[model samples]
Target: MPSAWLSTHLRASRPRVLAALNRAFGDIDVAEDAFQEASLKALKTWQQDDIPKDPAAWLIVAGRNAGIDAFRKKRRETLTAPEDLEPVHDGVHPEEELTLSLDRSVYRDDVLRLLFTCCHPVLRRDQQIALALKIVAGLSVDEIARAFLVQPKTMEQRITRAKKRLQAARLRYEDPDGAERSARFSVVANAIYLVFNEGYSASQGSELIRETLCEEAIRLARLLVRLFPGEPELRGLLALCLIQHSRRRARLSATGQAITLEQQDRLQWDRTLIAEGIILLEAALRKATPGPLQIEAAIAATHTRAARYDETDWAELDRLYRALEIIRPSPVVSLNRAVVIAKLKGPEEALGQLEQLAAPLERYASYHATTAALLTELKQFSKARKAYEAAIQHAGTEVERQHICSKLDALRSRVPGL
Candidate 1:
């Protein structure tokens, strides 16, 4: 009688319950412990019966009650009976129980407030990301470590240190205001972007895409927008995620090979998501102060609007990349611009632009892949072969490596003596 999607439901509801516990207990350590206790109860109860109608509310109320019992035991200098710690389930209505347990307003901003805390400036960026994934996204220690290409113990330590630092800082659970809120907003936004990118391309996994993680990132971005409705960048971030994720169906071929954008079947893309992304981007643009996310969303919009690859407005894309470089100069951004140049001008021009990037992008697999493509187009067979070999060495996933190897084989067949 257990629901097949019990894990998914638990993950989705964790943030709400954990956030509420943190607010009620006013301590991250106690909150995490109480939520775990409540989750065990749900695991036992939901298997025989159906999952609660309001899972988040159920977990929140149960966790709050459990945390209160722990406090009572601690203050009394004795352990409370295990039965006394269990959530009340003596035929009480779930909603009625939740309503009597805690005020609804306690959780209205719970997730957002938790996000701000995890991304506080005091923690290192890596620590912030790990904490957010564990606390907010409900990813396991091993899952988070796999995403970071680190050992599970390392990630565990990082999270422990981050929590300890937060506890030591004695930061309260309250909504930030004015400039502090703006700073925290940017930090939280960047962390969410990192989450989406890892899911989008999977930097260190056999699977080219992790749809669940991508969906989680999008969900978090939407939550961020609701919390900070006036922030244009949050809107842009959500729009960018939706537009990019619309092509998930076309990102890999039927045989699990990586597919290039030009070769992907356009019909496979999600039109509804594309339309919503475009609307959001247009609204963000009307604000007149374009952040990096807004500019990136505009560039993605340009691609989604084109009916066919040939119809793509490369000239305009070139302009946007130029603007992006001026705003945020990154080797990765420059590499993207090289693609536009290849389309607008020619391989020779694109190759020239790419050469200067070699040093900065020495270890980047895409740098080698792009170079190989441009070299192949110019009939520089020997150099192209080397670049393809390099790309294979640097490739993150098996699919990417296989794709590059296939290209190398095709080149060998075309030029008999190579």
Candidate 2:
């Protein structure tokens, strides 16, 4: 198999196979080691022979056997190894038998179990997201660090601490009961969204978006929705991801510059994804649960419903943001609401609202950028230039900096000496 194809397959299979190994062995370290060993073996084996019919099952079996071997080595036990053990049925290969025993529902449950384990209440929110991205999403430590806008060493320590905390907590490896699952669901969903947001607008990189992380997040969201079909929040979460992701194609220019939503070409948007997201949003709204995800999805749906930029229902968006603020009040939500308010009201009123947020969103790049935009609209060129400078100073990525700089350059053109 080609290296690219093989890499993609391995990444896609990683969560399921690792979850299975973790469940079987009851050790995160052992499961990770086993998966690594299996991947190494695959690199050599698949190149020589044809790829396995079910690569995930093959890895699970191989990894399980590898884990047993490692355990035997650690204990120096004379126990019969996995390969030495007799098959459950006559003439049945061990891998074949194990693969047959495992089914789709088992894999889905394993993935969910792993997600919940990573998002255990014992760990902090940042740790939950970082660990899930590492263990379940197969993101490397550096990748996680980049997403968090922290040093790799710092991220490494955080992840190590999280695992140590999990070990100390003695979390159960079995599937969570209904109460436990429900309790942990919110954190799990938040972690997944954090992952998606990191990809949707990467924290720091040459590229504006990270397709792999986005795809992995969508896949995890789909898994969650399937596992809890009646959870309106999960449906809303999936809808939000799909709707936002539909614009990925138009989010960046051919030269890789960041493109604001209003400036993006709607013709490039994926209508299929938009339709699916709308359907999910409508279904979830019918449930009338009214959660944060549903409100955010409603916001995105409202944006997509507009055939043109000027046609967007700014009033409805303002209402949704207010509803979101009541449910999940945060500086970020307030900042976004101010932007919608700028559209429905005026720049002065929006600027007043933004000023109230300055204290809380001092270090946020988008806050500065939005302020600069409002200032520019009001012909406050000097203030806009200063705000744009602040935005550039706090910008996460090269592309983001470039985009803000472009605005600054345009402002300078308007006020030559200023």
Candidate 3:
């Protein structure tokens, strides 16, 4: 129990722990390695002695000292073991040490600085997510790989390459400003959303949702909102995450299979999150800037508002999707808009829109899945079967493949065709 508690504490405290270590050591890799070493020490020591009053402060001190020793050893310089450092006597507060460890004003906030570092522009989006999950969100390589639908070794290599790229860039631990700051903010926000999306509908693995990734993204989004309190888009981003995550319980069936939105039990949703998300979205709309995130949040809010599937405001939802399409044009956006069209107009119209997307979305499993769903509704069972098969081939996870197989089998039984 103590170990589990310590593990949870370390994970929650990781950003601060890592930021303090980076402040002392000046290398992201060193900070991560030092924090890991300190975590091991805490597992051994906390069982005997009571956990420190300030665990983040404790981890920082322990990790910083470990980093210094490692750095010395790496360069073949003289080493001062942690045992040689001054020990805290019984009931003596470590306030001064904590102050010295974290008293840096180089950035507006340490966590934000660490986020910027992880989401450095040099690394690709996947690399940014991998590095941020590793360094900022405290996810294991295997966990991140599961979220990304990649092998553990592949994720490990990706994180390694990302770190190497960060080192080569020689990025500083300072808050960005000016045009550069705006660009970095966009990158950071996108990376956070990507993390949330991965968790919302895990690209791989048996689980329909990975709560850790979703929680981490929300945590980071909350931090960003605080850092930029006046930014409407950031608030919209937070609202979107809140509303989407509210359905976590309803997103999967009792047997751990994906449940479509129409089948999800709205009663199972988290009202607290929905209320908070609505409040946030309301505030964002008051700003009148009308950014892409706000539009998307509005779309999510529409779904959250409906008491039943038939009660959904299809007309309003369709308009929101069209607005989103204009703001951010892409094949995926078009596909979503088509789904809205199906709900509003008819399956025939939606099918026509989907046909145009084939050239762009041929490799996308969701495109095939959506097309298959529309075709099945139209009673074009043979065409639906082909689409379902294509979807199965491109499915990202075992659960997805199984879901598509079930659909295909149902269609085959009804249609009496290959």
lDDT preference between candidates 1 and 3, better one: 1
User: All candidates' TM-scores?
Assistant: 0.82, 0.83, 0.83
Candidate 2 ranges with C-alpha deviation above 4 Å: 2-10, 37-58, 77-107, 121-130, 139-161, 173-179
Per-residue lDDT of model 1, residues 1-418, tens digit only = 2555776778778877788777767777788888898788777777545677777777777786778778877766665545644655534336466656655445646766788788877898888878888888777898888777788999999999999998888887555677776676778888888778877873355443266568878988987777666788889999999999999889887777878889889899999999989988888888887788988999989998788989999999999999999988999999999999999999999999999999999988899989998999999999999999999999877777888899999999998888
Model 1 weakest 10-residue run by lDDT: 202-211
Ranking by lDDT: 2, 1, 3
Model 1: clashing residue pairs?
none
Q: Alpha carbon lDDT of residue 198, candidate 2?
A: 74
Local accuracy by lDDT, each model = 0.82, 0.85, 0.81
**Best prediction by lDDT:** 2
Q: Kindly list the per-residue Cα lDDT of model 3 for residues 194-256, writing each as its tens digit.
A: 888877874365453378788989998987787676778888999999999999889877777
